[model samples]
Target: MRILFFLAFFISITCHGNLIWSKTGHRVTGHIAEKHLTRKAKRAINDLLDGHSLAFASTFADEIKADRSFSKYSAWHYVNYPMDIRYEDSEKSKYGDVVMGIETCKHIISDKNSSREDKVFHLKMLIHLVGDLHQPMHAGKGDDRGGNDIQLQWFDEGTNLHRVWDSNLINSYGMTYYELGDELEESVDKKKKLEIQAGSLYDWVHESHQKAVEVYASVEVGEKLRYQYGYKYNKLLFEQLQKGGFRLAKVLNEIFS
Candidate 1:
C-alpha cells in the first residue's frame, strides 16, 4: 500500500506537461506535412484553417496556454512512464497524456456529428500535438518533469535539458523553417519516406522514448553544453524533425483521405 501510494504521488507531480518544440520545429513538421498531404486532405485543411498552411496552424495548442480556461490541457503535452518500461507496461497518467490528446483530436475531427467549431479546434490541436509527439524530449521520463529540471547552460546561457532539445539546437543551426524543411524533402527519397511513415503512433512513442534515453545520458546536471554538443546532436535533431513531418502527413492523410 505504501509503495502504491508513493507511486501515485510521484505521478501526480511529475506528469504535468512540459513545453514542446519551438515554433520553428513545429513549422518544419507542418511544412513537410503540407508537401505530402493528399488532395482531399489539403482541401479539408484549407476549409478548416481558412486556407492557412499547416505550418501556420501548427502552434495553436501552445498558444492557448496563457488562457486559464484552457488549463485542462496542461497535462496533455507529454506522457509519464518508466525509462526501461514500454509505454503499454507502464502506469498511465490519470490527468491525460499526448496519446489521449491525439486520440481526442482524431475523434472530434472525424465524427460527422461533431460541430464545425469543435472540428476546427481539435484539428488545430491535432496538428500541433502530432509534431509534439516527435520531439523526443516531450517523451522523456516524468521523474525530471521531461528534463525541465535538468538545469544546464547553452553556450554559457542558463537553460535546461528540455529547452536545449526543444529550441536551442534548432535555433543555433540558424536555418529558417523553409530551408530546413526543403533540405529534409530533398534528402528523403521514396523508400525513406515510406519507412518514416510506416509506424503506428504507439511505435513512434516507443521510438521517442528510446531517443530520450540517449538524451538523458548526454549530459550531467548543471553541465555546460557548447558547440561540440550541438555538432554531435544536429543529425539526430534533423532526423526527428523529418520523422515528425513524415508521420504527421501519414496521420492527416489517413484522417482526411
Candidate 2:
C-alpha cells in the first residue's frame, strides 16, 4: 500500500501542468485593461463582444479547453525558452506559441475582411494570451515542463512550481478579481503605468523570462512555501499583473485606433 501510494503521488506530481493563469488572475487583467481603454476602443470592443466586458471575455480561451477542436491551441498558452537563450534565438513551436498566438490573433482582428465571429473568437483569445504571456512560468524553460515537474509543498499541501505561481500565491490573498484589480491599479503612478506599457511584445516576453529565472532561484524542490514565500513574491506578482493589463490595453487601443 505504501509503495502504491508513493507511485500514485509521483505520477500525479509529474503529470501536473498548468493550463493558464487562475480565473481570478485573468479577470483581474481584463478588468485592469478595461479601465485603460480608449473611448473608441471600448465602444468597438463592446460591439465586437456583443456587450460582454473584457473581464467576461478574458477566460474564453480557457473555457473552450473542453472542446477537442481547441486541443490545437493548447500550445498557445505558453512559450518555453532556455535560461541562456532569448525567444527570438530559440527554436519555435510548429503548432503555435504564445507569441505567435498573440500575433495571429492580432492579425485576424485587424483584418477588416474577417467575419464578426472570427474577430470575436480571436480577440477573446488575444486578451487571454496576453495575460498568459506575463506569467513568468508561462515563459519558462522547456525542460521540466516549465517547472511542473519540480514538486514542492504549499503549506503542507503537495504542489509544483508552475501551480505555485499560477494560483497558489494569488489565491492566498483571498480577494475577488475586482478587489485585487482595484488594489493593483491604485498602487501604480502614471509614470509607472507608461513604463509597464512601453515595451514591444518581444521585450515583454523577455522580461517575463527573466522573472522566471528569478522565481526558479527563490525556491528548492520539496520546500514548504507559506507566508514568507508569499510575502517575498507578492509585490512582484502584482507588478506583473498590472503590466499585463496596461500592455493588453495598449494592444487593443492600437488595433482599434
Q: Kindly list the per-residue Cα lDDT of model 1 for residues 26-87, writing each as its tens digit.
A: 99999999999999999998999999999999988887775557879877788868889878
lDDT by residue for model 2 over 7-26, one digit each (tens)?
76565433433757888999
lDDT of 2 at 132: 96
**Weakest ten-residue segment in model 1 by summed lDDT:** 9-18
Model 1 residue-pair collision total: 0
TM-score of each candidate? 0.92, 0.93
Model 2: per-residue Cα lDDT at residue 2? 91
